[model samples]
Target: MVKEIVLSPDEIIEYIRTEVKVNDVLEIAYNRVFAPGIVLGITPEDEETGEGLRVGLALTGEILSDYVEVDFHRLKDDILEIRHNPTGDKDDEEHLIIIEAEMFDNMDQK
Candidate 1:
């Protein structure tokens, strides 16, 4: 079996522009804004749909203790759907590394 890969936040951003063969299990290192924990199941960019990267917040580790969880399959459906901040109307897309706070809270719910 191929070994899982762990990528930093910067690398995750890079994957958005460049296509990378994602492993079965992918880990995204902690980003201060998202808290300190690894995010798993990073969906690679979908060329056909022209979508960006979307990463799942893992259920295990510090995330679990904090009551955060991610639906891996749904997150992979459409990367473009991911947004920054709780409100969908936010204009924070200009930020290089952006994650939707509401998306995390919504996805993390059991």
Candidate 2:
């Protein structure tokens, strides 16, 4: 079975710290697009930005292949759902995070 949870920005950071690990594959959905990438690393909260967790991902696509860092703090309100172990495996499962479409809509304003 898959477990779905809605968490605040801080809670999400805590969850990632305890549950997620490097090299784990993650699927992030935003702006009606799914970007699946391997987890590179997780950065702790930065006092300057007051941001919680910053996840680095190596995204590869047909046309574009690059490294991108996702600031969970910025997408706090945009986070829609977090699905754990979507494959229903007792161990060795992946995560899928769905964000609201508007997340990228106003990206330039951020």
The predictions' CA RMSDs to the true structure, in order, are 14.5, 6.4
For each candidate in turn, the TM-score is 0.28, 0.59
Model 2 clash pairs are none
Off by over 4 Å in 1: 1-12, 15-32, 59-110
- Across residues 1-110, which tens digit of lDDT does each residue of candidate 2 receive? 23456565557656766776677666665445555566788887877866668778776556767788877667655555443333322254344443222323465565
Where does candidate 2 have its weakest 10-residue lDDT segment? 95-104
Q: Of the candidates shown, which would achieve the greatest lDDT relative to the real structure?
A: 2
User: So what's the TM-score on candidate 2?
Assistant: 0.59
lDDT for model 2, on a 0 to 1 scale?
A: 0.59
lDDT of each: 0.35, 0.59
Q: Which is the leading candidate under TM-score?
A: 2
Tens-digit lDDT track for model 1 on 15-82?
43353222222222232223222343455558897454555443334434332344333343223222
